[model samples]
Target: MSGAAPMRVLANATELIELLAGEGALPLVDVATRIGVPRPSIYRLCEGLAAVGMVELLPDSRVRLSTRWLALADAARAGMLEWRGAPEVLAHLVERTGQTAYLSVPYGSSALCVDWCQGRAIDVLAYRPGSMMPLHVGAAGRTFAAYGVPLPEGDRRRRTEKTIIDYDELAADRERIRRDGYALSEEDVTIGIGAVGVPILAPDGTLRGALSLGGLVEDIRKHCDEFVAELRAGVERLSGV
Candidate 1:
């Protein structure tokens, strides 16, 4: 007799998170369409995310991810690694390549360096803990941007003459990065400093973060294949594969 009085469960927040992540910033309509949920339900989920610092509601009625996710990810990294991120893995890369290695995650519309291990031969430190880089500036940042993270205007503005400030060029680079599963920033942030970056994705295919190794341009280029292999191994380990 009560079969007609069936209860309904609400959509999980993770669904909303994964949608926003795959499509980048989007208006409620896009999310609703993608998830086959009503616009109002999507709006409600977005509102909840905005309240929790997981997302930001734009004046243009779009929703974007907030930087707070980075902090949460760092917290989760605890006990997994001695600190936050694949420190032991990064150390291995440093040992193999003799370059500074780092783990970066989306910081609002930018990229934040969560953890790093410096190589023995390095003299300059490009990104240390708490150091933020514009999403269009470096390998790590570009990795996030290419994988659906929004790039801020500051990243669009050139830092040095070598930086890729042109939107068209950046778009082209994004395409390449998407296809390759990795990227190289050739002095795009700082002269004489270059990096190779790979995206770290959650099992759900959401972009959780990125990993990068920075050093001289030629050095990274010389060991590009090796670095990518090591980086992939590190990612597999970090992911508990």
Candidate 2:
């Protein structure tokens, strides 16, 4: 094959991988439709990926991630040591606030929970590690959307009836979060739950992740100011380290 042809094929494969990572699973027809490629082209790409163990074809003909990708992710994490300080940070947050603390990053149209530390209380099981959460509803999600990542396109239709839903209202709140250096939600995403979030910025001043504390709305309300202050302090401490 010519050099240009090989480069084109590589680009196509990369795009296919991104789509699979974003959507989790896709059928050949759906992939073709979304990528605007011909069905045969998508089939050939999937076949090549499956052959290399980068993807898998399920019994129902749907395609999803393969173990090879997980291996690669593990290797990358081990190299980067992304979680080197995460455990201690989480423990400190949970101990300081007596509430569940979580770290989340933007993942496609959602926020992916990377790690969590639960308080001594038994009610801290709402958010599970590796869960994908809506970016338009929760405190952490709103902080992410306000910082750079846009809210999910479809969230406008499924407005959060429990809290703020108007796009303009949310946009205004985003401005406040930017100014305040923190974000708060009270019975907004999940009923009876309140949360405070602070953006995690990289040394280059780019948003890298978010840290949040969760608790019962009433309890959070009673101590909202103190909690926000503490959470902000913790984020600042983490940033300096």
Local lDDT at 62 for model 1: 86
lDDT of each: 0.78, 0.77
Q: Provide the lDDT at 172 for model 1.
A: 94
Error of 1 at 102 (Å): 0.3
TM-score for each model: 0.65, 0.70
**Which 10 consecutive residues of model 1 have the lowest summed lDDT?**
1-10
Please give, for residues 1-241, the per-residue lDDT of candidate 2 as tens digits. 7899888888888778877775688887888887777888888989999998999988887888786876676565456455557667888888888988887878776777777788766574456555566676777888898898887655443434666667788789889989987888877666778888889888787988888888887877887788877776766666666
Regions of candidate 2 where Cα sits further than 4 Å from its true position: 1-12, 81-83, 105-114, 118-137, 148-167, 185-194, 202-206, 214-226
Candidate 1 accuracy as lDDT: 0.78
How far out, in Å, is residue 32 in model 2?
2.8
